[model samples]
Target: MFKLNEMAVKPVMIADAGFMYAAKMSGQASHYDLFTPDAGELAFLADEIAPHPFYTRGFMLHTDNKVTDLVQRAYEHENAAQYLLVKGSTDYIMNQTGLLFSVDRPSVESMEAIGGTGDTLTGIVTALISTGMNIPAAAYAAAKINRIAGLYANPTPATQVIEIINQIPRAVEKVLKEDHGGSF
Candidate 1:
């Protein structure tokens, strides 16, 4: 359902973080910048100096958590739930690089929760990351997908994981085609 270029890329593990899958293994993906920290580092520094012009009043960004701060880039206003989201964001970021977004998506067996969210996004994020996108960009892409899926999951009150998962690739592709071209 995508435009060509569907060559399969191997699934690299999160356990071994690297610029490229091979690099994490010891600079095997030497040709690529597999797992450099620069992506998140720049995002952090840039936001610190020239924070998003969009953030007003109650708007929050992920600072408490280093990884979420790097991936989320920005956080929308939340009332009582702010504390939990902040905690979750922080926990998620430090542990995950771009892969977590996809991993967090629900699986098909999710009855207690929506299903296949992760499965759907897994393919999308992995593909993009393999195609030379860095962890942050890939993470952002996956996060965007997750958000969309979240919205789709509920579309009323709370987001359902399934809806967000299903719509991720379309949303990601749109961003890729329209706004994202450079580094993460």
Candidate 2:
């Protein structure tokens, strides 16, 4: 990862799932700029003793309500990145200091049952970061964009991730127009 810092223009690094696990295991999670984890994965990060997500303690409930506590624990254990975008029913954007934003509006309940929603969120955040937006702001905006996309897709139990993916352009346009005055 040191090579990343060697670049003339340092890239904003974001990790999810397996990459996040690798970062935590290597004791270098702080080296990255952002981590996008669902509550279950956050539980893994919070458990400093857990070697893998499967080993996360049973006491650490993987529920949306426990997100704040798990985030604190993850930071306390130094197993979190500089920024965390906890993806769940209510997406949370936070840093070491505390929570910055929680996006649950335009809620699309059906999206939860569809696979790749969390991955889609991470991708949106990455794209936003690539556009020169600050990590925290990108995370917040990405959450909004993702939910908006899900809403536009009108997902059902059978909705495919590609259906949501197809709406990303419209979602980005809507979010930027509404939130950023039609520009990134």
What would the TM-scores of all predictions be? 0.36, 0.95
Tell how far residue 40 is off in model 1, in angstroms.
Answer: 24
Model 2 deviation from the true structure expressed as Cα RMSD, one decimal place:
1.5
Which runs in model 1 stand beyond 4 Å of their true positions?
Answer: 1-11, 15-92, 95-112, 153-165, 177-184
lDDT of each: 0.37, 0.91
Index of the highest-lDDT prediction: 2
lDDT of 1 at 176: 66
- The true-structure Cα RMSD of candidate 1 reads 14.6
Please give the lDDT score at residue 79 for candidate 1. Answer: 9
Candidate 2 TM-score, C-alpha based: 0.95
Q: lDDT tens digits, residues 76-159, model 2?
A: 999999999999888999999989999999889999899999999999999888888889889988999999999999999899
Error of 2 at 18 (Å): 0.4
